[model samples]
Target: MLELASNLGQAPKAEDLSKSPLSIRGLTVSYGQKPAVFSVDMTVEAGKMTAIIGPNGAGKSTMLKAALGIVPPVSGQVQVFGRSLDEQRARIAYVPQRASVDWDFPTRVIDVVLMGLYRELGLMGRVRAKHRATAMDCLARVGMGDFADRQIGQLSGGQQQRVFLARSLAQGADLYLLDEPFAGVDAATEKAIISVLKSLREAGKTVVVVHHDLATVNDYFDNVFLINTRKVAEGPVAEAFTAETLQNAYGGRLATAQVDQLAKALA
Candidate 1:
């Protein structure tokens, strides 16, 4: 469970700090001269579903990519389970944005999911029967069992998203970082994905999502980290998600009425 108290001004509780699943300090990233993320600091607790909320171009995805070593950071450090990323890569799973993938790669769904086991299977290894079963199980978890034989290009947008999620499930990592998993997905897929995330939390796994929907943040996440080029606010959802913080994060892009509606909902 996430600690409800704000950890903004003070150091994290000693006991909690030592065991945090992900810890980032003074993280800065830049594309040439322009900075995308600046001096961000955050600690994500294990077994909590956390949402990274921010406006467009706020570096929400960039921050996640940086943590995964996909995007090189200008400065700062990230620790996973008190170890470097390379040392703990096997324990982390990443699901990139759907648009980033080449869906027309002429690959079968099960083959794509099997790629998750690459860490276990060396570069020159073969897929055994047990690995196939594991991939199928992951597909079933994401409600994509039936489409396991279909070509990746034939699936609908929601279905493709589900397949990507299944691949992450196949990794069976202790920590998950998902970028825009709900974008352009159907209601049923959304529900199914949330169910999987909740299940991960219940099973003592930590999930961090780069989420866009303000209305569903509290509903889907136990913790929230608001960012806009830097850390704006972070803590338990009920306490960290506020009208003022949303304003700061979105730069007043959200209408006053919209903020009021969310504020009322939270209250």
Candidate 2:
């Protein structure tokens, strides 16, 4: 019984780190002729929670999109589970920003979650009882099991985010890429979401969240990537989430200047 408990406490290993769960080398992304992210290199360890944070237009979202192959990168390489993304597509799950999705589509919460199984279902297939069971379990994980039958439109902002999170959970992938999971969410909801993310890490999933609130950076993340059109720093929160690093990443901007002045004044 003790051995079983010990094994349960250990995070499930994914691909080897010498191979890397997700690796980007000399990654450059451009929209048309304008470069958005340049010469970026980063690695996400398996069974860890990584937060990518930066101001608006900092190419954070662009980088994630590029990694997912949604947008073609001008030059670079992306590997998932030590294999090319195409080879490991089924092992990844993406949760886009709530603003990017149409919440008023008139779909039930359970139906949206079951959509995560579409890749496995193929075009000609319908959701089976097993799929429904998986979706229910996922909803329960996110504390939305009771709302499974509710219309997505009737839910609040945080509830909507939970629906998406449930969908990602249903995918049962090794890696999860989430974009701003806490935007506009109430304090209680934010805590709930963070708890779910921590649970994911405990369950041996690699969860990457694109975050905006800097105040909670240190409190919420195990690893952090500070990005602004380029890789500023990537490592544990204590090492990378520094004022100097943030200044460098957001420098040359008026807001950054104002912040610098405020810091100096306060000091």
Candidate 3:
């Protein structure tokens, strides 16, 4: 179900594999004097689902924002499909954490999903009937077609997450950058999102997620990027998602049982 690449090891220094779906080199981010991410480097291969896994405050979400050019990096470069993110904006879709969004915003579920097409619609272009149909189709893909006209605030946490996924799906992008899409969602929603991610890989699209659940990393993604302010390790899940690697990334903060379970899985 997952394709494992042989090159599973620590990220190289300043090497630019721009030809890859996503390439980050020497990326650094700081909040005033506090460094959030320190000279991180990573490469996301095309046609795979890559999980950025680390403990809290490991700069996982910050890295995703930098890749999308949403958060300005103090230094370093981000390349999407061998070009600057701005130049390849149309080829990318981003799903931010649901907590970051204001569910109380006066908007319909369909309207929110249609926002994905705004890039194609432009300021002057009308949405038209086809666009609405497309939006509804995206909702249906996520099992929310029946709630298209409902207010976004009316949906449960899982449904809201699903709606956001539908928006990204409507974008028709080559690469998707999701920031904690699994946070606070129900089990059913988690299952649905995983299915969607697998479908994207089958269609030859790349998906990178800022994920926190180390337990599910292997089950959901083929590739794993472990970071903690600085990159700790990155490669295939089988190779990089090891107890030693997790300890290095989490600073021995993981529970003993977790470490034991990870070791058993590797064995």
Predicted structure with the largest lDDT when compared to the true one: 1
Across 138-229, the per-residue lDDT of candidate 3 in tens digits comes to 99989898999999999999999999999999999999989999998999999999998899999999999999887788789999999999
What would the TM-scores of all predictions be?
0.94, 0.87, 0.93
Best by TM-score: 1
| Candidate 3 structure lDDT | 0.87
Please identify which of the two predictions, 1 or 2, would achieve the higher TM-score against the true structure. Answer: 1
What is the TM-score of candidate 3?
0.93
Q: In model 3, where do residues sit more than 4 Å from their true spots?
A: 1-16
Clashes per model (N, Cα, C within 3 A) = 0, 0, 0
- Per-candidate local distance difference test: 0.89, 0.83, 0.87
Model 1 lDDT-worst window of ten: 1-10
Candidate 1 vs candidate 3, lDDT winner: 1
- Report clash pairs, candidate 2: none
